[model samples]
Target: MPTQQSEPLPLGDTIQRYGLVSRILHWSMAALLLWQFLGMGLKLTLGRTPLVSFFTGSHQMVGTVLFVLILARVIWTIANRRHRPAHGDGLLGLAARAGHMALYLVMLIVPAAAILRAYGSERVFAPFGFQIFPAQQPEIGWMVGIGDALHGELGWLMLALIAGHVVMVGLHQAMWRDGTLQRMAGRPRG
Candidate 1:
């Protein structure tokens, strides 16, 4: 019987056009998203604590970061559309693309609506005295009500999107042994 000398996987050769900055931003955004969801959970259920406050404040900061980051992501995606994964004529792939587009829409809508709601609340959004949010007086405006309502509703929608995203990623990692999850990992496994 001969012992096998296995060849190493060609992972480096499988690299995406996504650069270091893009990869870093992608992972950081994913992690921060978990933290932000935890913060929202605390706000909804656990009530305020030092930890909750920390997470909420951090979530807001991260959300602000995300608002800008998503714009960058959009520009990058548009500029480098050719580098994207092969979304062939497969139905599953088409569905995946549709899911991606929905997620992107939610990404833009949720944070922006939250930001606007915060502005409507008339809270002093002075991120270093720079009026980080629009300064409108906190009145019982219908627009505020609608904004807040959709903002809250979008939370649940976002949860669904995130859950689906995770499930799909896990499915690819577990069943297909694909790089979906591995690429997002800090140090991709061999």
Candidate 2:
């Protein structure tokens, strides 16, 4: 018999739901990104203190790790492209696809720009205390300029996109009752 709408999805990517890898990547990135924002938000609001210092200190390292995770996610996504659940039909689906594409683009660019800036900076940046790039004698103007201009601005924009993503998930769960959340959380539909 054909699977019912209420059936729990498979362990791997299926027409009805995401696989374990996808769900793991999705939620892990969500948590790490939340930490990044939370730390920054506290720094901005509460000003510098020992607690804030702790968070800000880890920010660069965590951001670097996030960049690596994003790369892994992209690779996994490409490998699973054909087997993954469909976004659905019509305008909502198109919007979902566009939103996801935007998320990916921003995710890739945010840390990349920062890393570029780090590479070109006059002061050495050693994330996790491992010197990835030695300090330059003179800062590269264009690299620093790109990072200075886009890093914070695009970071905020990415945050907005993340907010929209959460709202959309809530909509799927509440308004549509589509079991969309189950694709990433819970046990699946039934």
Candidate 3:
């Protein structure tokens, strides 16, 4: 007897666009990154207000969560790399790839530095009330120094990269007329 064949299951990435998992990770991280920046921006502008407290209160915990999500996203990207949409050809493609790499590098570094500092610091880091790392004696001055030196600077650099990413997306839509945003957005503009 002949057996019936079934259609292949859809994947989480495609040459034309991103899939559910990729879109979710992209938007979720975008929101979290925005939250981090918003809190910092408010802190600088508004000083010690209740609103700032509300946002800044969860900053460390959220950054930790973002770090984990980013790691997962990177793994997912690697797994889907072959099936993913092309960055395109020539200098524009090279720029796109470089920009994305820079973004990913800074994203990983900023939080990793902070977590490293927390691990080596005198204060216990109980993100969401669960102690991940117990307090250390005398603190690891070097670790804290690394965090102090890199975290904020790399964070601002990440912000600049993010802004460039956004502007490039806008340019893709406005000038190039490429459906670049649709890769993560899931739908082309009407």
Candidate 4:
């Protein structure tokens, strides 16, 4: 006998049906991103203080968490992608995939640059002073300077990338309306 085919899940129903692991990762990442944004946003407007210290630590912590979670996500995606249900791979889908790839690249690059910058500066910037990234002696002063410049420029780049991500999501939701957003909107597989 042939294998049975499952029905397609309805739009707007993805969020309520996301698998446990998927939901957990999704919400955790979302929450951390929110906090990180808040931390950075405040740092831009608000002056330094004990409160800023708290948020900064939180932001760094969130960044660290994102690194680990993204690593896990990447591993999980690689390991189980074959088992994942198939979806369209057309133009809009290609755009979505490319956009996500860009996001992940920016995500990894920005933190790494920050880590290298911290290491180059011998700052040992740790979350809550825990020394997450230890100092390292690189080639020369130019290496350190380059790391710092890259780190700062990447920060600006990340700001734009984030905005682009939001716009893309909005476009997928508003313009496409083809279940692109719904698929990842925490919905369950049918």
Find the candidate with the highest TM-score and give its number: 3
lDDT of 3: 0.90
lDDT of 3 by residue, 24-121 (tens): 88999999999999999999999999999999999998998999999999999999999888999999999999999999999999999999889889
Model 2 Cα lDDT, one tens digit per residue, 1-190: 9974555445568766788788878888998899999888999999999998888878898899899999989988888889887888899999999999999999999999899889889989898787999998888989999988888889999999999999999999999998888777866666
Q: List the global CA lDDT of all models.
A: 0.71, 0.88, 0.90, 0.64
Per-residue error (Å), model 2, residue 36:
0.5
> Residue 25, candidate 2: how far off, in angstroms?
1.2
Worst 10 residues of 4 by lDDT: 10-19
Q: Per-residue alpha-carbon lDDT of model 1 for 1-190, expressed as tens digits? A: 9986634433222343344555665677777778878888988897888878988876667778887888777776666576554444688789889998998899889888877777776575665447766656655376577678887799679889989988998888799875666554533445
How far is 164's C-alpha from truth in model 2 (Å)?
A: 0.1
User: If the candidates were sorted by their TM-score against the true structure, best first, what order would they fall in?
Assistant: 3, 2, 1, 4
Q: Total clashing residue pairs per candidate?
A: 0, 0, 0, 5
Q: Assess candidate 2 and give its TM-score to the true structure.
A: 0.92
Of 1 and 2, the candidate ranking higher by TM-score: 2
lDDT of 3 at 51: 98
Please give each candidate's TM-score: 0.79, 0.92, 0.92, 0.70
Ranking by lDDT: 3, 2, 1, 4
Which tens-of-lDDT digit does each residue in 49-159 have in candidate 4? 778778876766677778788776666555555554344479866875776677677767766766665666655667666876666655346657766777557766766
